[model samples]
Target: MRFSRAIATAVATAALAGSAAVCVPASAATPSTVAINAGGSAISASGTSYSADKGNIGGRTSTTTVASGTTDSALYQSVRYGMSGYSIPVTNGTYDVTLKMVENYWSAAGKRVFDVSAEGSAALSDLDPFQIAGGKNKAAQRTFTTTVKDGKLDLAFKADQDNASIAAILITPKTTATPAPAPAPAVGINAGGSAISASGTSYSADKGNIGGRTSTTTVASGTTDSALYQSVRYGMSGYSIPVTNGTYDVTLKMVENYWSAAGKRVFDVSAEGSAALSDLDPFQIAGGKNKAAQRTFTTTVKDGKLDLAFKADQDNASIAAILI
Candidate 1:
């Protein structure tokens, strides 16, 4: 995919502000690293050099003492508040992104609720630094892996309650691996995004006439197939797949990446015009947000087509991947 022209325009603007928005090539042999202090000046700590405030929008700096448990307190001491987000330039590749944060203003949870998106896809939803770090001045960090086909990684922060803020940013390149072949007698589909190969199984990119929307948010735990669960199709009515007339076991992978509570999302699944799973709550089954859960059922396809229907009881229906 070609780089977004809007990103190129932003990078040109960052150039006038003395920001590090240069497009640098990154490879496996010598991968490039990026570190930036959100609202502070340039500094070097722990043998890593951090750039000064750059590539940000509509924010100011605030200095405060950071609590223990982290050696790099300077990184978390100065934060940029009231900013929309950041757009940093880099070569097209996959990178591991880490955001350093602290709740210096609010003491209790729910005071600051926001979401983090990378490349226009959800990376984190409803994040609270105070609750995650156990205190106001404590450090809280969130990390995720995302691919960047464009020449830049655009991050957006939308606050639900309070103003959005961040202390520092770290972006490191990752080595790409060879893709594996798909297994026979099994059809795997990454429900709402690009194709992915994981756990010796190759899943193709999402393709079907399903009536719904798609999302790309990373899941926290409970499975090694994070790529499979990171993307999903939500608010769908049903999907139909052509198959041989035989009995087959179908697995529907799911995760609740939006809501934290259990009763937020509930749905039912039916296969071949019969009940397969009744009232499936992903958050309740997985115990929390950003966790993986699944449901499997056996059905006989007599009409040479496997029909799967989903009906929502709560928010909406969501599915990450499908296997048959």
Candidate 2:
């Protein structure tokens, strides 16, 4: 499947910002040797059986290791030109994943392209090593954190414009604590915008590093009724709030602080694709600029998540706060 251009842009932007965005926690990375291989039998020259690459003999490429932390230079040839990564044993918990690669083939970009997904979430979209490393025969390392829940943390390399290849896969434990079966009452960000902690909640679409998943644009704590106002998140068009399968009252705290005039700010809000609010205008509801307004709608969240999708008419959509 193809990657969403919007999500790809969001992730690429975050990567350039050195934030890893929703892909990883902001902590020092230390990847242990989970598995590594070039292409062949599940054995390396150094006799590292656990780290051999499950290979597609037809797609094997010859490459030399740069001698950084690699165990076997010849063992780095096990390329998964076909098939997804699940040959190793894994458990539920946070992990530091490091995909080691050196340009063994292809001199320029677009020669090799693939999509990477970890634990059913997009880690990298339209990945091209030649582009990431600037050229072939060079070394490049892509690191991120992923949590395994279903016995094994699946890392799939789906063919994009071209085949996906990996010289080796390194997975290291992040923390000693076991992954929680279910998180606490999902982060219902209170008023007054501040940086959203990555450890807070699992996000989708609009959910980002700063604001659940995306960075929050505004924090309304003291300007108006500080008691009523809180932090607000705005960025992409779609967002998902993680929650257990159940029904709950979803409240929206709206403010006409940004757009002063009517029709200047118009958008649609939906829950599970059903129209909850059509052509919602905060300025109209609040009656004037810098006024506070709110609306509430109750809906059931199936699949352990509540999707909040927005579409703008005149300007971008916003959320001052959400209370569950």
- What tens digits encode model 1's per-residue C-alpha lDDT throughout 194-261? 98997898888887636999988654556777878899999988988887788887988889989989
Stretches of candidate 2 off by over 4 Å are 1-33, 38-50, 55-78, 176-324
Pairs in steric clash, model 1: none
Query: How many pairs of residues collide in each model?
Result: 0, 25
Residue 186 CA displacement from its true place in model 1, Å: 22
Q: Write the per-residue lDDT of candidate 2 for residues 115-170, one digit (tens) a residue.
A: 88887888877667655554465445578888876556677678776667777676
TM-score per model over all chains: 0.47, 0.38
**Runs in model 1 lying further than 4 Å from the true structure:** 1-31, 66-69, 177-324
Least accurate 10 contiguous residues by lDDT in model 2: 201-210
- Cα error of candidate 1 at position 258, Å: 27
* CA lDDT, every model vs. true structure: 0.81, 0.60
